[model samples]
Target: MSSTSSDIAITGANGFVGKNLRNFLHKKKINVLGISRKNFRKHASEVKITSTNLLEPKLQTKLKNYDALVHLIGTGRRSPKSMFEEINLNLTKNVIKACKNAGIKKIIFISGLGVSRSNKSDYFISKYKAEQEIINSGLDYTIFRASYIIGKTDYLTKTLSKQMKKGVIIIPG
Candidate 1:
């Protein structure tokens, strides 16, 4: 924040997509400031969180000077405390609020593929809600509904491997 504006600010920059995107952006000489939920501390102007909850409203003061935000804070899998809507939608709400507070426009979000208003699946519904929040927030935004990404120990791939061992490939219709 002391220097000029950053090219982009990434939420969930510690995750798989965020890591790859940051690397690609860096190669293009784009300066990135990252926000993470995991324990992250500025690593050469990248790592930027420790017990970081993007939901906190007070931190909006420090979220300034970023040209755009890449919102990657979401989950496909779920637990009791980490339900899809609870984490995904809520975090997105937080991001929108922070963006509004910081006067930051243009957020880029990667949402789940095949998610729609009529989607019956809980995961898709969660993503749809998050998307709707961004749309209604009156901020410039882009939502990318991405299909399954494959890589070493990635989320989808890991889940597929685990379920395969259980002798069931639960493909959602």
Candidate 2:
């Protein structure tokens, strides 16, 4: 099926990066469909939200009509190692498989910078594993390994700003 009219499907559309993307795409007059856990009431006119658990069995059937997918689902902070595997590894695998099954031609996956298989952190390991899945999927893909994105209300920036306000900052060795 041709994906001429279908909108771009953005996962994690309620997130900081997703919000920025949504605004930019809206300004460009591009249609955006958001797959988010919560309702997007503010941008409801320009974006449509679909509440979905990424691991659900019905996900492929639900996402069959989309033109392309922008996968932004991931965890940044430390958590149980299994959480990383679930969200970063398994969830990504499911999405890629679903897109392939649905005949979706393109995927733009948001990944973290400085991730490697040799890294000690479980976070980086999970990201690397996820990227591997995408690479081996045999689908048209763009993997954006991004650094810290600057936004006015970004959590990282806010935390950094707060720390800088204090006298001396200690760097981890």
Candidate 3:
């Protein structure tokens, strides 16, 4: 792809981090295409936004022309094991496959920290597995693992703040 051609695709663009990233990328004059469940068209008039579930088979063809993909789709809330696997693991696999098929060169994945093979939590385990899958896919991939991101409406911060206010401290093992 030519340096002048600016085409970037971002998944989970409706989420907090994704929205912030999109804004940041836009400020740098990058042409961003967002894929999300909610419409971001009004907020980003110039940016092309598509609302679709990543699991759908149509996503492959839809993502064909993009030069790179920023995959941020994941389930953070506690849920069933299958739900985590489906969103974090299976979705990543599909995204990798789509990128490979579409000849996309680079992929930037937003992942969580503390994801390891030895981890007991399903969430972290699934993240580790997804990272492995991305590595094995042979695409140029970059993983950004964040721990307890601080945002205005961050769930972790809110929960911790509430607990602190209650004067009852409970630490996760």
TM-scores for candidates 1 onward, in order:
0.80, 0.84, 0.82
Roughly what TM-score does model 1 have, to 2 decimal places? 0.80
Report residue 13 deviation for candidate 1 (angstroms). Answer: 0.7
Task: List, residue by residue over 67-146, the lDDT tens digit for candidate 2.
Answer: 78999888877699999999888989988977888777888998889888898889889999999999889988999999
Cα TM-score of candidate 2: 0.84
Model 3 worst lDDT window (10 residues):
41-50
**Top-scoring candidate (TM-score):** 2
83: Cα error in model 2, Å: 1.2
Backbone clash pairs for candidate 1 read 40-49
Q: Please list the residue runs of candidate 2 whose C-alpha ends up more than 4 Å from where it truly belongs after superposition.
A: 1-6, 42-47, 55-62, 164-173
lDDT of 3 by residue, 1-173 (tens): 33886578888888777878788877877777678878764345345556555545566665666799999899978799999999999989888877887788899998898888899999998899999999888899999998867777666777888999999877966
> Over the stretch 22-67, how does candidate 1's per-residue lDDT look in tens digits?
8777777677777776764444645465436664654565567677
Candidate 3 at 40: error in angstroms?
Answer: 2.9
* CA-lDDT, candidates in order: 0.79, 0.80, 0.80
Backbone clash numbers for all candidates listed: 1, 0, 0
Q: Rank the candidates by lDDT, best first.
A: 3, 2, 1
